[model samples]
Target: MPRPRYLLALAGLLFAGLAAALASAPRDAGSQVFSPRAVVPMVARDEGAPPPPPATPTPFAPTATPTPRPPTATPTAAQPTPTPRPPTATPTPAPSGLRLQGVNWYVNTTGTIYVMGIVVNGLSTPVELVRINVRFYNASGQLLATDTTYADVSIIPAGGSSPFWTLLLNPPPGVASVEAVLGTYSVSSRPPITGLTPTVTNIYRSSSIALRVVGTVRNDSSATYQFTRVIAAYVDSAGYVIRIETDYLEPSTLAPGQQGTFEAIFFNAPAGLETNNLLIWTTASR
Candidate 1:
C-alpha cells in the first residue's frame, strides 16, 4: 500500500524495464524452443515439401578453365643419303708383233690406184704369212675403199721388214688418204733348216725386167734333202724386202755333202731395191 504518487513512479519504472528487455530479445523465433510440439509441426511441413528436393546439390564447383596446351610437333623418321661412286678408267690395247713402217698412196697409170707400205717384225721371233689391209679415205675422213695384200717375203726374219702392195681395181673418185695395218700374222716354232752353205753372186738386173741371183748351195747336214729350194729377197736401202723370188735346183734331190747351183730370177723388181739375199731350205718329207 503506497501513496498515489509512489505507485505512479513504480509503474513507470516497470514499463521502462519491460520495453528495454523486448528490444534486446533475439529476432529469429527459431533460436528459442517455446515447446516440443512446435518442432513436430515444422517436421510435418518439411515432409510435405518433399524434403526440399534432397538439398538440390550443385553439379560442380565453379573454377577457372584449364588453359589449352599448344599442339605437340610429331617426330619424323630420318632418311639415309646414298653415296656416289667414282668413274672407271678405260684400258689401252695391247701391242702386236708386227708394226707399220711406212705408207705410200699413188694413182698409177691406167687409172688404177695403188697402196704400198712396209711392215716390220718388231719381235725377236720370226713371223710368217703376214697379211695387210689398206683403208682408203676421203678428205672428210670417210672410208672410200679397201684393199688387201700379202707380204713380199714368205717368212719375215726376226727384226726384218717386208713390203706390201695393194692395187685398187676401181678406186673411188677423189681418194686422198690411206691407212695400212697388219691384219694378221702367224708365228712358226718349227725347227729352222741348218747346215746349208749358200754362196750368192751375180746380183744384177737383167734387161730391166728381171733380177738375176746366182748362188751355189751345198747340203752339209747328215740328212739327205729330197728337194732343195732357193729363196732370194730383193732388199732396199733400208734393208726392207722389196721383192722375193724362188728357184729350184736340177735333179731335185741332193745327197749329203752334195752341192748344186741355183739361178734365181725376179721379175718386176722395184727400182729402189739395192741389194739381194739368199736363203736355202729343204721341205719336210711327207
Candidate 2:
C-alpha cells in the first residue's frame, strides 16, 4: 500500500514540474487577445532613402549689334534753242552793135524811085534788131523826107546773110538827084541778108483841094524789114510845092523769094496836083 501511494505523489510532482518548464520555453506560434478600448498608431517609413540637396538660380547673357546703311543721289535739268537760214540773189545783162551794111537810090521819069541794099556785116552769132533811122536828100542837098523804122533783124550767121530793098517816087520839082542814109541801133551775132534789088511801082496824087497823094512801095529783100514815115511829094498846076500825107506800113519780113507791097496815103496836100508829078519815098530797116 505504502509503495503505491509514494509513487502517486512522485508522479504528481513530476507533472507540475513539466507544466512550469513548458510555460517558460520558446514557442513558434502564439495567440493574443486585444481589448476594444486600446488605441494603436502605425507609421510606415521607406528604407534606404537619399537626403535632399539645396537649390541654386541661373544668370543671363548679353544681345547682338545691328549693321549700318549707305546714302542715295539726285538728278539734273536741260537747256535752250536756235533759228534757221535764208536764200540768195542774181544779176542782169547788157546791149549790142549795128547790123546793116549800105543803102541805094533810083528814080523814074514818071516820078518813081527805088532803093536797094544788103546786110554786109554783123555778129557771127544770131541777134535781134530793135530800131532804125533813115534820111533822104535831093540834088540840091534838100531834105526830101526823113523816116524812123523798127523790126527784128537777125545777125549774119556763121556763113549766111540777108538782102533788103526799098522804093521812092514822086519828087518835088527841080529835084533831079536822090540819096538815102540808114542807121541800125541794136544787133546781135547772127546771119543776115545779102544782094537785094528793089523796084518802084507807081506814084499818083488825088484830085482834091488838099492834094492827097498815093504811092506803091515794095521790098525785094531776102529777110524781113520794117518802114516808118512813108511820104510822097508833087508840084501842082498853080506852081505850088505840095507835101502829101504819111502813115505806117506793116512790118515787112521777106522770106527767100518773097515780095511785099506797101501803099502810102497822104493828107494835108496842095490842090489840083497832076498824078504824073507825084513822088513817093521810104526808108527801111534790115
| TM-score per model over all chains | 0.43, 0.28
True lDDT of residue 174, candidate 2: 45
Best by TM-score: 1
Choose the strongest candidate by lDDT.
1
| Ten-residue region with minimum lDDT total, candidate 2 | 34-43
Give candidate 2 misplaced runs (Cα > 4 Å).
1-102, 130-132, 148-160, 188-286
Candidate 2 residue-wise lDDT, 1-286, digit = tens: 5799899999999999999999999853212111111111111111111111223666665475556555564435554545545645555422222234323333433554433333333334543343334455544556666544443223444323333444444545443333323343333543344433333465455544333333334455555555433544443333222333344444355444554455655332323334425534444456
By how many angstroms RMSD does model 2 differ from the true structure? Answer: 74.8
Backbone clash count, each prediction separately: 0, 29
Error of 2 at 62 (Å): 99
Whole-model Cα lDDT of every candidate shown, in order: 0.58, 0.40
